[model samples]
Target: MMKARIHQRPKSSMQSGKAKVGQWLLDYEPAEAKRLDPLTGWAGSGDTSAQVRLAFDDLDSAVAYATAKGIDYDVVRLGANPLKLQAYADNFK
Candidate 1:
């Protein structure tokens, strides 16, 4: 059985504005353990599902897709994004 994870995307560190923070993402768990490649010594596996990332507008849509696809999934809910507002003069304190 395929397993997946659903979670909200957090604000990126590079941007001051929140973008796509409301989007939910579905990531498939790796079905097999990664093994070291003999030639390059890089970890890789035959399971391609781990590379797939599905985005949804909300949690319900993501969950619904998983349910309809018969994929067992776990949802990870995070607390609200913390935003601290302060005046420029506050930096002097």
Candidate 2:
């Protein structure tokens, strides 16, 4: 059976924008074995599903996609981080 992961995108610590925080991402777990090419000594897989990343505006939509595709998924929920409201003058202090 194919497994997928559903999780809300975490806010970037480097910036204070909410561009991708509200989005949920669905990622497929790799179910295929990676084989090394003897000529190049490189590992790769032919499974294209592992490379797919589906983004949804809501968690329900992401879950629905996995259910419709019959993929077993594990939802990872994260609690909201507490924010310390600071002003520009606070930086000087």
Candidate 3:
């Protein structure tokens, strides 16, 4: 008999700067580019959040896609959009 190895999925952390950017895009950006939130469940009350990254191949493509999806601001707070968050990140870079 051959032994099988079990692989585990990595835990998602919002503490990482990369993750923070992804979260901002998912939450505030339009919608299309937002990836399904990795942390959602049937009994969880709502759909999982989504995420996006600045390092994506095409910024314009991502923005266009997101815009077509009809942005949702349910989880986003006032004065906290992707544009502003991105600006903040640039400062650190």
TM-score of each: 0.90, 0.75, 0.24
* Sliding window of 10 residues with minimal summed lDDT for model 3: 1-10
The top-ranked prediction according to TM-score is 1
Residue-by-residue lDDT tens digits, candidate 3, 6-91:
11222255453443233223233322333454567322223223232222233344445455665422222334334333555678
Shift of residue 77 alpha carbon in model 2, Å: 1.0
lDDT of 1 at 5: 93
lDDT agreement with native, every candidate: 0.94, 0.92, 0.34
- Please give the distance, in angstroms, between residue 22's alpha carbon in candidate 1 and its true position after superposition: 0.3
Ranking by lDDT: 1, 2, 3
Off by over 4 Å in 1: 80-87
Off by over 4 Å in 2: 80-92
Q: What TM-score does structure 3 among the candidates reach?
A: 0.24
Of the two candidates 2 and 3, the one with more favorable lDDT, higher being better, is 2
State the RMSD for candidate 2: 2.6
lDDT of 2 by residue, 1-93 (tens): 899999998989899788889899999999899999999999998998899899999999998889998999999999866877789999999
> Candidate 1 has which clashing residue pairs, if any?
none
Question: Residues 1-93, candidate 1, lDDT per residue (tens digit)?
Answer: 999999999878998798898999999999999999999999999999999999999999999999999999999999855878789999999
